[model samples]
Target: MNRNILKVTLLAATLGLVSGAAFAEDYRQNPFTLTYKNAITENVVGKVNIHAVNYALNGVNIVANVYTPANYDPSKQYPAIVVAHPNGGVKEQVAGLYAQRLAEMGYITIAADAAYQGGSGGEPRNIDKPSHRIEDIHGMADFISQYPGVDATELGLLGICGGGGYSLKAAQTDKRFKSVATLSMFNSGLVRRNGYVNSQTDTIQERLKQASEARALEASSGEIRYTGDAQLTDEQIAKLPFELYREGFIYYGKTHAHPNSTFRYTVSSLLELMSFDATNNIDLINQPLLMIAGSKADSLYMTQDAFIKASGADSKELFLIDGATHIQTYWNPEYVDKAVSKLTEFYGKNL
Candidate 1:
């Protein structure tokens, strides 16, 4: 029950490794409240337009942003892609960035805040469970496939970070996705159950016991306890074990932060997360697949592991961005451009 061990356990679950004293942009001016660079301020007549939307997902209001291609014609058919955000990430961060970029390439894209997180509605926020996260992706596919001008038969999917892991699970049987792609893909279950690169393997049972007690507390007293919420100084961030966690603090905490994004989740979520694995039944995915990761990312093993197990993919390719670490791929322009170019090619051919 040491506080530090609990903090690390929750941080691994939420994927927001560093918290406290983080910087966030003033997004009051942007109607969409987008925190990414060069976000759309206004809808141009012939340029891509972002539509803030909300819909019911199992009685909860799921908020999302759907981007329409330039000169979009409702009557014409257009392929669509669903962009899933990373763990502890909102639709306005990297998910929105990639959604907008793909829209510019003539693909209608949707980026949604997962239920219980971001702008979406859910009680006892930040659950971070595999079932709910996976359901969110499937819900997005359900909504976007019916959107105006979207060719239901030509739908594609793009998942980033933890979202990438859920996307693989959704595409496994959904099959509506003609193509599937992941960026800096993170296997949330593997990390939650085993710790980042199995760093906390020795304490797996202890954590599970803690998670059970947390769940019991929530059920009996309705008092929810959260974890992974910490206030760390610059020095602490620098000392993080993995480069991904270190850079993640700067990316989600400072360089590109949103008010809705957080690093905390109900401690009980680990009860489910501890046993979940994104790679479970991964070979069920039969569509074309493209998995992208950074050559230098400490988290690259998750991508490599999932890619190798995706034996059922009609076609599969693993592309590594040179010199890019896990978080750099989220915002660095050079790396982003390379990723977008490759995605454009992949979706163009497969979707």
Candidate 2:
């Protein structure tokens, strides 16, 4: 038992470091660590440690972390939120930071690893599936509300990067979430199928060929290599597909890097993502939706496009964070604060 505890502690430390590397801070400086060690107050009310779980969602056991406000009570229920981590991110990444900060502001925030990624259960680790990813959010909502001190009635969701699009899908179909908000929303499926809005179309033949080859490689080697986001050195980062990659690494690869995380994901998953389109049913979304993107982010167009198509949304708003890049919004104090303020106000009024 002592050895087991030691092993767990060691694993936690490693995971912590990895998460710290890719996420919550400037890698050139402190990297992402447990920086919010100071006092924080929120609904549950006190300083609480992050909790991990193997939650069953979408026929899979997904890993997640819940940040309950300090001073939690058994009697009083508190408002809660489901925070979906961005693509290639886990609960311990910046997503968790957002959840923790929101909890500090008096909400029960749960950030979860998408199915088949991070500590979550999926056959092919790091595989991105739209249906299952949506289920991950719904399942998080189900799990969080069931916790003893949480108010099941007051529920909200925040999705970061690719997670944003999935959150929209969940809100549209499940309707369990009273309010939904996104930060630097990336249309993963759309981007995969058609490069960056109208950039280019990757035909089905090539997609299938890639998936088929990836599957065979997995079968022969009994190992599935991932292509999540591809890591980069400071020099390589500068030469990435887009400037966002250079910046995204600061958020997900360096500052928030978790030992369990890799920039690479399963190539086969791209096929599914290419075909996936979270905004197809945007017209069906009725709950209040807040989509925030950086004005200068090349990815901004995706969120904007999604906002324009949603037909029946009674309360919907698209915010462009001035002078911010796509990934920079994750941990940027000014950007994140602006986002949280808007989110707090929205959930306060709507939820």
Candidate 3:
């Protein structure tokens, strides 16, 4: 059989399958360079890193990484933050970057791969349901809060991209997060249902029919169909229309490529994702909230819209990165620095 087919077949056999080839001894080495800046290495002097941590949540084993401040001691209490990765992302990308940076700033932070994706245990992998994603955030808070030296009362949350939307939902009832922050919030439901920028408004019913078919196939355990899974040539990528998808391909697929991260999600996931909206029940979140997005980012509207609807929160602010786009805020040093700075200040005041 062809390699790609073999890869998919193997993934379907079991949950938590690391994409491509057999699982490695250490996910931080060889083909897996977990961090964007490669900040983590063999000699971690002052700081501490615990990787591939397994924890049970919602009947699945979650894999996460914990980063602690220098001279970390379990006896002492310290503030903590749980970072949520973007959609189609694992914990190691931008989420790890933020977690490590926050750890450097004297906090215990964790970045966990969502169940059914990355190294986490889940069947029919890449399920990508809203409830599952939201639960992942709650689960992170559950495990990290129990970690050594974590001040459960001073916990904070930072959600990036699609994770941001789910964070809002999670924070609504999961008051364990004293403060909530989202960077480059992507309204997955709105975009999935109405299309990117509402460009597919004309095709809503048509796509729903397609999704229904996908769900039917899934029930029978038939051939699984996926969406947004593409390997594009450089020329093809350049011709893509939208900045979000175009730059995203380069970021997630090329420069930041991790064996575990893929754009494809089960097409059936749309059944739930399309009908869900992150901004629903916005009034339930009364905690300090900060939403950051690049001014040039096409997804800025989602953040702004959600921010406005967060009427129950007495303390909520929207900060925009001046010249960055959606994906640029992920790894661009200058942009990342700005985002982290705002987050540090926000968490400092709130947590």
Best by TM-score: 1
- Local error of candidate 1 at residue 216 (angstroms): 0.5
1-351 per-residue lDDT for model 2 (tens digits):
134422322121111122224334332232333322231223222565456566677577777777777676658888999999877676766687688778878887888777777777778666767877887888888899898788888899899887898988888877778888999888878776665544444344555566667778878987774443333356655655565655665544555556555545666666577678878878888988889888989788888889999877878999888998887687677887888888888889888
Model 3 regions lying over 4 Å from their true place: 1-32
lDDT of each: 0.89, 0.70, 0.81
lDDT of 3 by residue, 81-167 (tens): 999998888887889888888988999999999999988999888888899999999999999999989999999999999899999
Q: What TM-score would every model get versus the actual structure?
A: 0.96, 0.83, 0.90
Can you give the lDDT of residue 201 in candidate 1?
89
Query: Could you tell me the lDDT of residue 81 within candidate 1?
Result: 97
Model 3, C-alpha of 298: deviation from truth (Å)? 1.1
Off by over 4 Å in 2: 1-45, 197-204, 216-225, 228-231
